[model samples]
Target: MQSNAQTPDQYIEELPEDRKIAISNLRKVILENLPEGFQETMSYGMIGYVVPHSLYPSGYHCTPNLPLPFLSIASQKNFIAVYNMLVYSDPTINEWFVNEYTKYSKAKLDMGKSCIRFKKLDQIPFDLIGELASKVTVDEWINIYEAQLKR
Candidate 1:
């Protein structure tokens, strides 16, 4: 389920009290590790990391008016979710993330093509998440998105 929050702080404020700490920690990790040029905003009613128009004027391919998405954090009804587009666009990165998460985590990873679901705060490995967030540079993401357009 999406939130109605217009800003990151608002989103955090609206989250259930139990979920706030984990979300805040994850947001901190994302902000600290994310490459320069990716701005944090509320997109799709979730906390989003994006390459703003200044860096990529084309915006998102599916929705040209919006900034190009990089990653997003959401509080779902059943669990917390993290969507990383870089993992979806690049197979090698995807493979590395999956392998590393599995290797490092005690619990089985609950993940989809791009979204990683966490049933509890401890389910998330902050180091691995940070690596995934830092892996793709802005130029790399733009290149990947542009290449997808050609396909």
Candidate 2:
């Protein structure tokens, strides 16, 4: 299940055994919770669940030309991570994410522009992760993305 992130794999190659497992676990959680059609792709050295342009038509992440994406996941040098731009943009959800993730993870959890990083799978709040993932449907994503692109 481990694939090197080094070159073409773009997703899970360079990761150690533990990291690979963690990433896969996280991916499963995301997939189970998300709406279908959000593709699994490699972007920015991590797993990115992309909103295809054919479906959205406006653009990925809703912009006509902005292809940044709507969600991202990764197995970094120190941790496994997840990123959801829609949630990231909202302060309410950001606080919720931090509060929820801290409950189970003893390791350091890194939060960035949109990414959430943790050292172990046990640290992630599976319930919260599912909740977040399920909330935004592909249609909602497209609308928001289009609006973002307008900006």
Candidate 3:
């Protein structure tokens, strides 16, 4: 569900007790592994990791005033969602993530284009998510985003 919380800490604090730990740990994993230059902030009501305007002034095409979003984690109604733009926009990364998911968790992959859904909190693979977060840098994400825009 979308949150009205202004900060990442606030967002986590608002979650139900059952979800608090999973979302918190996921946020921790992302913060620990996300590349330099990506800032953690509240974006689109989720805990977002974005390339700020100082790094890429053009901002997001859909919302030019906002920073360019690369990744986000949220507590959804039925599952926790991890949205990674790199996984959605880059076929190589998608293939790699899909291939590697099986090695990490016994749960079958439940995913949308960029949204990875984890229903069972205990089954979440924090290491795999961390590795995914580290797979792309801010500059690389900007380049990829620009390339897609040109298409």
Highest lDDT against the true fold, candidate = 3
lDDT of 2: 0.68
Is candidate 2 or 3 superior in TM-score? 3
TM-scores, each model vs. reference: 0.96, 0.74, 0.98
Residue 77 displacement in candidate 2 (angstroms): 1.6
- Candidate 3, residues 1-151: lDDT per residue as tens digits? 7999999999999999989999999999999999999999999999999999999999999999999999999999999999999999999999999999999999999999999999999889999999999998888899999999999
lDDT of 1 by residue, 1-151 (tens): 8888888999999888878888998999999999998999999989999999999998997899999999999999998999999888888898899889877688888989889999977778977888889997899889988887788
| lDDT: worst 10-residue window of model 3 | 135-144
lDDT by residue for model 2 over 1-151, one digit each (tens)? Answer: 2344643343655666776677677777887988877776665556777777667554543345634476777765666677888766656667876777767566666778687767656777766677678767777777665565577
Best by TM-score: 3
Question: Which clashing pairs does model 3 show?
Answer: none
Global lDDT of each candidate = 0.89, 0.68, 0.95
Ranking by lDDT: 3, 1, 2
Residue 130 lDDT in candidate 1: 83
**Candidate 3: where is the Cα deviation over 4 Å?**
none
Q: Which residue pairs in candidate 2 collide? A: 3-12, 3-13, 4-13, 4-14, 5-13, 5-14, 61-145, 62-145, 62-146
Q: Tell me the spans in candidate 2 whose CA falls farther than 4 Å from its real position.
A: 1-10, 60-68, 102-109, 149-151
